[model samples]
Target: FVSEAFRVFDSMPEKNLVSWKAMIMGYARNGFCREALKLMYRMEAEGFEVDDYIFATILSTCGDIQLNEADSSATCYLETS
Candidate 1:
């Protein structure tokens, strides 16, 4: 399922927030926290703002993985979100 999702996502000529949210949530729900977070970073790099829903999902996913509190990127999101 994830692989198929990745294939579809990769093939999209232009991805919007909804498509990114779906992929991120799908990965997080499936125990792929790392992938989800990676996508979030990529989303930001592409100039997509991580809204509240996406932010909450990411926080939950980070909790599940026990993400390091000292990680600068994580701290930045925590502070800004």
Candidate 2:
């Protein structure tokens, strides 16, 4: 499913931040937190500037799954980056 989304995204003529955010959020919502975080890191490493909505979605995912570690990591990521 994620691979399909990435395929579509790759085909897009102009990939925007919203597109990336949507993909990341979709992954997180589907219990793919590791993929979500990995993609987020990849995006950052590629110099994409993430916005508030991205952070909010990740935090929400952590809360939804009761992952304290993820929540703390998200909070720390937000604070530091």
Candidate 3:
């Protein structure tokens, strides 16, 4: 579960940009659009410098967040091992 990943993330003594991106992408890819967006804002609040990857990753998920509930349930349930 991504919750497990977050545990590790939370414990990090330091987080670089890639760490933020990985967590954001995990939340996004797991259909947690709001979480990803919130994390993006949190990343900004933490004073990390933004790059093209940040914009691209968050921008790519705009449509995901806009989906109606029905469409979201049907379209965004990705299974993982």
Per model, how many backbone clashes are there?
A: 0, 0, 0
Off by over 4 Å in 1: 65-73
1 against 3, candidate with superior TM-score = 1
- Compared with the true structure, model 3 gives a TM-score of 0.69
* TM-score on alpha carbons, each prediction: 0.79, 0.71, 0.69
Model 2 residue 69 distance off true place after TM-score fit, in angstroms: 4.7
Q: Poorest 10 consecutive residues of model 2 by lDDT?
A: 62-71
Candidate 3: residue 56 Cα off by (Å): 2.6
Write the residue-wise lDDT of candidate 2 on 1-81 in tens digits. 877987887688876788888888988887777677777877777779877777777767756554554666666777798
TM-score of the candidate numbered 1? Answer: 0.79
Instruction: Please provide the root mean square deviation of candidate 2 (C-alpha atoms, Å).
Output: 2.6
For candidate 3, lDDT tens digit of each residue in 1-81?
999998998799999898998998888777776676568667877998556675556556646534353244323322210
Ranking by lDDT: 1, 2, 3
The candidate scoring highest on lDDT is 1
Tell me the tens digit of each residue's lDDT in model 1 across 1-81: 998999999899999988999999998778776677788889988999987788678667667434554245667867776
